[model samples]
Target: MSDKVVKRPFVNNNCIGCGACIQVAPNYFDYNKEYLSEAKKCETYNEQDVNNAISVCPVDAISWI
Candidate 1:
């Protein structure tokens, strides 16, 4: 198997204040003053959890870089 690395999660401009990411991975995401979901200050290197959060985003605003 090739060793691939999952990048950290990031919120994009498409965010619609949905809480799906937060619900799926609270440790990696939080809401900002604009009610938009954003990545938490601490890096959540857990690829699975981050991917789960990305998958649940209704707006598909979450991505990795």
Candidate 2:
């Protein structure tokens, strides 16, 4: 029952695992086994936080699909 969005966010290969995304949106972003930032949840509940994470990405990796 996930009210998924048409364009969910994702962390691309360009991610440097800076953990900024996690810091910005802990409920959505997390570190993988590779120590990289990955999207734990793609839901668009608090878009402002997500946008903040996207903007803070040093490598501009996070995006919508």
Candidate 3:
């Protein structure tokens, strides 16, 4: 198997419902029922794409796992 680790975005409970990340990278994130930001599941994205979203998160809730 390839050693390339599939990096997925994760939004922690510290999210403040800010859409900054979504605006920066909609493909990697979305809003939950509680209006909080959550990472889209079951998908792999480029590091740059995920990093853009993470950089825009004011609450620093987004990360890679």
| lDDT for position 10 in model 1 | 89
Report the lDDT tens digits of candidate 3 across residue range 15-56: 999799989888878899999988887545778878888887
Give me candidate 3's TM-score against the actual structure.
0.85
Candidate 1 clashing pairs, residues 3+ apart or interchain = none
List lDDT for all candidates, in order.
Answer: 0.84, 0.83, 0.83
Q: Write the per-residue lDDT of candidate 1 for residues 1-65, one digit (tens) a residue.
A: 24555467889999998798899899989999999998986633578889899888888898888
Model 3 lDDT at residue 56: 79
TM-score winner between candidates 1 and 3: 3
Q: In terms of TM-score, which candidate is stronger, 2 or 3?
A: 3
Of candidate 2, the 10-residue stretch with the lowest lDDT total is: 40-49
Models sorted by lDDT, best on top: 1, 3, 2
- Pairs of residues at least 3 apart in sequence or in different chains that clash in candidate 2: none
Q: Any runs in candidate 1 off by more than 4 Å, and if so which?
A: 1-6
Q: RMSD in angstroms, candidate 2?
A: 2.6
Regions of model 3 farther than 4 Å from truth: 1-5
Best by lDDT: 1
